[model samples]
Target: ARPCKIVEMSTSKTGKHGHAKVHMVGIDLFTGKKYEDICPSTHNMDVPNVKRVDYQLCNISEDGFLSLLLENGDMREDIKVPEDPSLANEIRSRFDNGDDMLLTVLAAMGDEAVIALKFNTK
Candidate 1:
């Protein structure tokens, strides 16, 4: 499942004694794809367990895999590049240029990887 952020919410009443349906409009946080859903107020939706963590780009393999160093001194080499082509290109470019990079990794539950690179202003 992809991560989603609700941008709008509207409710509609079918009758005097009926359930209220909520119309939710959301945009994909990464892909910027528009998504909309209508459901009862009592309906439960799946929310992705996401966390933001800092990672350092240690290396890049010939196959284009990123080797990241976590805050706890553990190495993670399986993170895929983010879906945004421009962001992905920027990340690689910064790594190649030997920039001081502090990557904001969006760790989503079990599969954790979305790179938001922040570089030193100097």
Candidate 2:
């Protein structure tokens, strides 16, 4: 992971029949690595309402939240240990569905929001 800052955001109608979309560009504040991603629509409000600085902080918070969740002992019980085949399949299916939804939302973020996220490696 690298520390980064959102430098710019832009949105445009994806296609005549498709929904609007947001594109974000970020620069690594520490190492100067740059990145770009399309934000889904659901994240649209996350950017503009929060602004660039706030958005970066929020991303850090989110990453922390995920890390904490993964570290918590309770999460170990949330899934079958030793990886039950059936349970693993079900979990994978659910994750795939969620990923699709996330992609859809990300692709729909309009220009007003800062869709870029910066992360620092531990």
**Local lDDT at 14 for model 2:** 64
lDDT of 2 by residue, 48-94 (tens): 22223211111112121211122223321111111235533443454
Instruction: Please list the Cα RMSD from the true structure of every candidate, rounded to 1 decimal place.
Output: 2.4, 16.7
lDDT (Cα, tens digit) per residue for candidate 1, span 5-87? 88999999765877899999987665678999998887898998778887777887888777888768999888777777888
- Give the number of the best model, judged by lDDT: 1
RMSD of 2: 16.7
Which residue pairs clash in candidate 2? 39-106, 40-105, 40-106, 40-107, 41-105, 41-108, 48-113
lDDT of each: 0.79, 0.37
Alpha-carbon shift of residue 33 in model 1 (angstroms): 2.2
Shift of residue 25 alpha carbon in model 2, Å = 0.4
Cα lDDT of model 1 overall?
A: 0.79
